[model samples]
Target chain A: MADKVLIYSRFPKTMMTRFAEAFELLDTAGKPAHEVFPAEELAGVRAVLTAGGTPLGGAEMDRFPKLGAIVCYGTGYDGVDLKAAAARNIAVGHSPGANAASVADIAMTLMLAATRRILVADQYVRSGDWAASRQSPMMRPQAGMPSRRIGVYGMGEIGRKIAARCAAFESEVGYFSRSRHDLPYQYFPTLEAMADWCSVLMVAVRASAETNHVVNADILKRVGADGFIVNISRGSVIDEAALVAALTDGTIAGAGLDVYAREPHVPDALTALPNVVLSPHIGGHTLDSHVAMQNCVLANLTALFDGKPLPHDVRPEGKTA
Target chain B: MADKVLIYSRFPKTMMTRFAEAFELLDTAGKPAHEVFPAEELAGVRAVLTAGGTPLGGAEMDRFPKLGAIVCYGTGYDGVDLKAAAARNIAVGHSPGANAASVADIAMTLMLAATRRILVADQYVRSGDWAASRQSPMMRPQAGMPSRRIGVYGMGEIGRKIAARCAAFESEVGYFSRSRHDLPYQYFPTLEAMADWCSVLMVAVRASAETNHVVNADILKRVGADGFIVNISRGSVIDEAALVAALTDGTIAGAGLDVYAREPHVPDALTALPNVVLSPHIGGHTLDSHVAMQNCVLANLTALFDGKPLPHDVRPEGKTA
Candidate 1:
């Protein structure tokens, strides 16, 4: 008998199908693979390979009597019940550092778009008012440059990359991290301080319980009316209600967000603000990034099937059981 | 009697009024300064300072019997007919090198805004479609770093500044010029070649008969569907008709224009496109740029008042007239 594998991601099936031909592949895309055990369908399964959305808990693990390992197919393993897997003596492997560059690129794009008012210009041209309104006083304000101070709320790989990019434009790059590093730029002691100092604040931190609501009403107010905020890390990083209120009340200049509090669901307040630039959670969805992440998944999948210790394993703990 | 000065630029009167505390200022923002020489407002004038739109043409120069100097209160001298002024021994001074940094800043802002689809996402948020389309496919396209080729059409001060900003994003920068100089990036032999090589092109060349229609249909076609064009220099630098056709046919992806072939007039075809981004030719209009340009005008005015030779003069002849 061949080793069984499960996949749960928005990857091209052709790539996975080719890999499956070489092994006992059980794909779960449109429908859960019957041969592979989904949490609810877990029965006599030896191992599992899943995405961020599939929640594997203690209840499901009980069904897989002989399960030894679970492989997360992406960089984040937020949905996995790691503690339950650890208690059952099952190892969990995950891919890391694969989509950092792509995520960084998205962050910069959002920042540039929001700061420069690209969409506003588009409307001006498309509405047939550009020529007649060219000399209008309303047109005069469009002729300016980006703000001086730039703030990054996270000092992770993506945040660091964005900082380096901002430096190229001669923008004063400042960052808020767990512990300040000796970077070429300034490092604020706290996120609120960073917001206070910078005119453009970008959130590149992760989405976790401890880090939730890091950018709330108080922080947004500190950012002030002349400032801008961008969140590329996670939707939970910012309180959406506070952000909308700030934008509505002119507490801050504008915002650029790639992720929201809920996936595939955006709040009406954020959607109603002309100042905010919002993109679906796509900070890590570039072609280059997708290919990189998929390759990492393949590497881990190949390692697990060979019955050897995985290169990137998550010691399951403190997850929803 | 105090020397008479005619102000032709539509600047905020408050600023001019403050500066005029030292001079016999004749305000002509809305109406002609003097009805006696309506056509030649500079007639019997010691110095003349005109804004961005007022063109001092050949026929008008013949009437300025007492005009000692003409001062362009902005960097672009296209509005002033230098050769005509020179023929009559009238010195014309312009504010060159004044707005280089500001113009460069706006050019980069436009590039970043267009490439990242910033404005489009903003509309998405403002239209109350966030929840239904939070994870829409359009939003996902900009999730990571953009790895696209960028081209600069001019290699002057503004062009170089744009190049510096482009390199900051790790974008491959290439350029075209009348005569290529040594630079870190690649230099294409022709505009078509540059277009072929880049997914985004910035037109930063001066608008002269030589540069008119430089970006024709062939160049647009070379730019292809994946490419975009940005013009921060002059409108005539691009062939507007060809551009309209290219956009309509999808020969190029889109454009971000700050200048139009006709001042204060945009073409219907160009205006109808949703992809295009337009601003009312305010690329070099900034607070810093205005101060620098005004200082240049002041220099020319002072030179005329003192009967000294004018600096930054534009003599239209191949040689100084």
Candidate 2:
């Protein structure tokens, strides 16, 4: 019999068909694998294909006695129980740096839309207000991007790309990272210092327990009344409640958000506020990025089935191969 | 007596106050001088402060026998009867290059919004469709900026700036202009060829009789089904009927328009389309650009009143100082 592999997430049909050629693929997407598959059905499963959202834990792994590898389709495998997998001697693999360009594009898109009042402008035209008033009330005379300071909270691949695009618009780019990379952008050791120095604060850090709520009320206050904040990273990287309060009280000028603390459940407070631009969490969810991620997953699974080291191994300490 | 100047358009209160410091200001912003001013009241008018929308024709010029100069507040004096002014020995001045940066910024904003389906995404989140569907239908897997060809219809200051920004996004920039400019971007002498070569065609040419309807059905068809068009220049530069037809018939993929053939009157057909992003003619109406334009207008008026040559003299043959 062909080697059995459990598919824990939905992939493109073409990719799934390609995988099916080499293994007996069992799909359990959008439902618990334990609930979807009986013990006997999962007994021969030696590999699993998953995503950042549908992670495999010890309980799920214990059901599959022959499981040897867990390959995640995209970056950020935070949902996976890495310690549990490590103790069980199961290898973990995930795609990294696969969606940086799309995320950076969305980051800049949010910034420009929020700063330029695109949503308001579109409404002004659509509502026939422009014809009646003969002027755009959406014009905030002080709003512009040129020569403004843009503070990035992280200087990883996505952050660096965002900074590069901002530079082309004549913005002064600065950043706060754990350790200074050899980048030409001005470096700040603390988020507060960067917020104080910038007119636009961009949150682009990876989400984790240590980085959770990095942009709290203090950072918002430092960003101040004329400042704008944009978050394209994971929602956990920012304190959403504090951000909403700051926006409500005018601690900051405005915001552009692509992620929320409880996604698809944006607070009524944020939805009711006119000073924020809200989007569903779609920063890295582009067709090109999806294809890259699928390719990475296939490569990892292929390498594992051949008894070779996984191409993008993830460890318990948050390190990637 | 301070030389009397007739204000034909509404300027910012601050700008008008500054002009008041130098001249005996007569405000007729929304009304005709004939309706607002009696014959006696118009007798001493030695200059006219107008916008492109308010033309100074022979009849208006005859009313003010002492009129020596027509100072326009912004660029695009196509509406002003330059021959009539020149024949009467009345010099013409306008603010040139004042709003280039702002217009360039908006051009990029529209491009990103249309290509990335920002307006639709915003609507998706706002209408709770994202929450219900849990995924965006706006994701076109092949959509991106990297390695794409951006064909600029004009190589003016704003066009060059737009190209610079597109370059930072890794787009290949090309242009179609009447004559070659001293730039590194590929130049096509014909619009049809450029449209064929580009995935995104940008309209940035100035409005004039010869340039009217430059981007018609032929060019749109050449751009094909996978292409997008962005216009930040005058609405007359395009054939609106052909564009609407093409957009309706799917001859082109999408469009981002900031200007319309008729001011304040967008066709229901254009507004009803889903693949286009529409905005009012506020591309260069930012506060920074307004201030710059006002400053330029003031400098030009001051020079004309001081008996010095106009700083930005717009002649009948489309030449400027």
Candidate 3:
């Protein structure tokens, strides 16, 4: 019999095909663990696989006495009760930087789509507004990328990639991070200062208690009426209500979002707006990213099964929750 | 008093505001020259301003016997009868490379949007499909930009900018231009070879008789079903029927087009497809680009009125017709 692993969060069956081949997966399909498996079955579970944003706490860990590892599917592990896992002597592992390139690619996609008014232009051609020589407010010539200010909120892997791409387009790149790094981009003392200086604010900060709702109304005001905000990081970083109001009242020009405060439940107010470009939370959903993350997960899981330390362990500093 | 200048094409009044201040304009508003202005107005017109895509043949020049200078408003002079101007002892001037950066920006926007399926994702979010956790083919993981082959079909101003932008995204860049330059990108001898080698074909070639329909069925076949094409060059450079068929039959995965073979009259078959991202021919339409082009236009006209050589004269080789 194969070693069993519990699926702690909902994921598509296709994504689990390779994992299924390697182990007997106790798939709960996002249901309560007790409802899906007997206590004996749970007791035999030595490792659990989970999505990064699913809530997993010490209470859940205590239910499985044999539990030795918690593995995150992607770069983030914010929802894992890291402190509790550490206290329980369980090794936590995540695929760091596996999805950074894809996330950065989506950031540029959202920025360009929103800034170019591409959707509006598409409708113009499709609706015959362009053919009829109609005048639209959006048809007014937009400012090009040259000399446009792009401010990144973090200096992590994704933020660095975004800054590099923006710089290639001849945009001026700047950043506000917790600590200054040796990157080529200009550094700002605070997020407020960067927001005030940049035309486009790219939110790539990691999710933490301090970062929750950090980009509130005040930051939006600092971004100004002519500026744009693009968030590819956790939606919790932005106060959703404040962002909607800012977009409605023109406190900011527009927004491009991939993540929301709640997954799979975007507010109708946001979907109804013309000035926003919205996507489902899929910033890291590329094929290459998935493969890379799977390799890391495999490495971590193989280590645990062999009674060894996780080679891809989540750093101690990452144990926020 | 401002010098009399004939406006041979229709343009938005706002776009002409600055020029109106510099010239006494006899606006044809895209009507026949003879119908809009009398013989006296035509005879008095020494300089005519025109959009680069509007057809201006020698027959039209005969209508304005005293017309000494034909100034194109944008970078291209493909539609101007350059040989006729040369034969008539008339100077042709254009704003060369004024809109390269803006055009290149839109090129990247279209490439990223179409390749990433931004429109499909947008619809999935708006229709509550994402909220319902529905499966979409478009939601399947896509390839990231790293090491992806980007083949630019021309190495002109816009092409160079596109290559630079793609390089910043960490893609493998290549080109098939008329002549080789000292750029770091790989050079393919022909479009067919590049089409086979690259995953994304960026159409940035100059429009000419020799280049018309150069990217036909065979070229698109080499691009394969997983590939994409982005055209920012003139509409006549592509074979429209073949492109539509290829898109429908999955000969190629998708296309992002800013120009069409027929400008205002796109076929319904082409517009109804879900795989293409369409835009009006607004590649060079940006405030900064226009300002730069207008300054060139201002210089060309100023030199013409002063009986000096047009400072921005069209080179003899651009006389396509």
Candidate 4:
């Protein structure tokens, strides 16, 4: 029999074609993989391709008795049960750093859109308000990027890219990361210190159990009434409830958010607030990123079937399995 | 008599207070100087402070017989009749390069907004479409700033700033201007050739009779189906009707416009198109630019009154009068 593989994520037609050439494709996109396929149909499944939203726990892995590897479709693999996979001696692979540039671009997009109030300006021009009034409403004056201080919460690849872009606009760039790199930018040891020093605070940390709700009320308070915050990292990295309160009480000036605590479900309070710019989690939804990630998934799967080391294996905590 | 000055534009209270200390202020804001002010009121007007929109011609100058200078509020003085001012020996002063950074900021804002489809994304999230659909609408994939060619139409102060910012995003920057500069960017002698070579074409040329309708149907045709155009310069620099048709057909991908041919009157046809992002001539409407321009205006007026050479004098074409 042909080596069978289960696909638990939606992919473009081209990527599906590539998968078909290598294995017998069993698609369970937009549904729970365990529930979608019968026991007999999943019996010979040796590997699975999943997206970030699909939870692959011990229970799901138990279904595929011959399962050898699980490849995540995107850079983020938070939903994948790494500990469970490690215990089962099954390899876990993910496309790491594939969408860094795209996510950084979205971070800048949200920053500019929120600060410049582009949505409000577009509405003013489109609704005949500009024509009727013949004058732009006197809005709070926007401070441009030049000479302003920007504090990045995480200084990984994405954060570094964001800082580089901000620096080109003549912004003073600073960062807060767990350990300092050899970068020229000033490194703040704590999040609150970075918030206090910068006018615009950007969150770009990775999401893990330890990092959950890292940016809470205290950090927002330190950012204060004149500062802006932009979040392009995982939604769990920030305390959404604290953010809502900050925006409501004017503890911070404004925010640009791409991720939410709940997938596809944003709080009504955030939508109602005028001080926030919201976009569906689309930071890595570019064509270039998608193709790169697809290639990564293919590479991981090829390496696994050939009985070679996975190109992007995920480790449990501080140790590699 | 205190040196009488006619304020032909609406200025901030602070600017007006400063003007009051230097002249007998004749505030003609929101009213035509020739029609609203009688002969008696305009007789002793020794100078006029106006914006780019307020035309200062020989006829308006005739009302202010003692007018020694006309100080323009913003950088562009297209509305002011330079030849007429030269003929009447009325010195003209304007704030050159005052809003270059701000305008360049807006140019990048539009380019990113259009390419990323930010307005549509904002609408998608705000309307709860993401919650209902659970997936973003699979539109054409966005190719980001990195590895893209950006063609700047004019390489003045604003264009240079824009090029520097694009470079930071890893875009290959090119320019088309009447003459060459010492910059390292590739120079395209013709606009059509630049359009063909670039994915994003930014129009930043100053509007004059010679440069009116510079980006017409021919240029848009060369920009083709996958390209975007950004205009932070004067509206008349583009042929609006041609742009409307190109956007309707698939001749060009999209546009980010901050100006229109008619003040406060955006065409209904242009408004109906989903491909364009529009703002009401607010490229330089920032607090920083405003204060800088105000200081420039003040300096020019002070110099003229104190019998010093005009700091930012506008000489007539090919003649210094």
The Cα local distance difference test for each model comes to: 0.72, 0.82, 0.90, 0.84
Model 4, which residues run further than 4 Å from truth? A10-17, A134-138, A315-321, B10-23, B134-139, B315-321
Could you arrange the candidates by lDDT from highest to lowest? 3, 4, 2, 1
Candidate 3 residue pairs in backbone clash: none
Docking verdict class for candidate 2: medium
Q: What's the candidate order when arranged by decreasing DockQ?
A: 3, 4, 2, 1
TM-score each candidate. Answer: 0.85, 0.93, 0.97, 0.94
Off by over 4 Å in 3: A316-321, B316-321
Where model 2 places Cα greater than 4 Å from the true spot, the runs are A1-3, A10-24, A53-56, A134-137, A314-321, B10-17, B53-56, B134-142, B315-321
Q: What is the DockQ of candidate 2?
A: 0.59
- Among all windows of 10 consecutive residues in model 4 chain A, the one with the lowest summed lDDT is A133-142
- Models ranked on TM-score: 3, 4, 2, 1
The candidate maximizing lDDT is 3
User: In model 1, what lDDT does residue A182 have?
Assistant: 74
Error of 1 at A228 (Å): 0.8
Worst 10 residues of 3 chain B by lDDT: B312-321
User: Which digits, one per residue and each the tens of the lDDT, describe model 3 over residues A29-138?
Assistant: 99989899999899999899998888898999998899999999988888998889989999889899999989999999999889888989888888888788888998
Candidate 4: global Cα-lDDT?
A: 0.84
Report the Cα lDDT for residue B67, model 2.
83
Prediction-by-prediction clash tally: 11, 1, 0, 0
lDDT of 4 by residue, B1-321 (tens): 677888887655565786688678888774777777789888888789887755567887888888889888878877788889888888888888888888888888888888888888877888898888645543446787775799999998899999988998878999999999999899999998999899899999877877799899999988888889899888889999999999889799899999889877999998887778888777877777877887888898888778887788776458553
With candidate 2 superimposed using the best TM-score fit, by how many Å does residue A6's alpha carbon deviate from the native?
3.3
Note the DockQ of each predicted structure. Answer: 0.43, 0.59, 0.80, 0.70
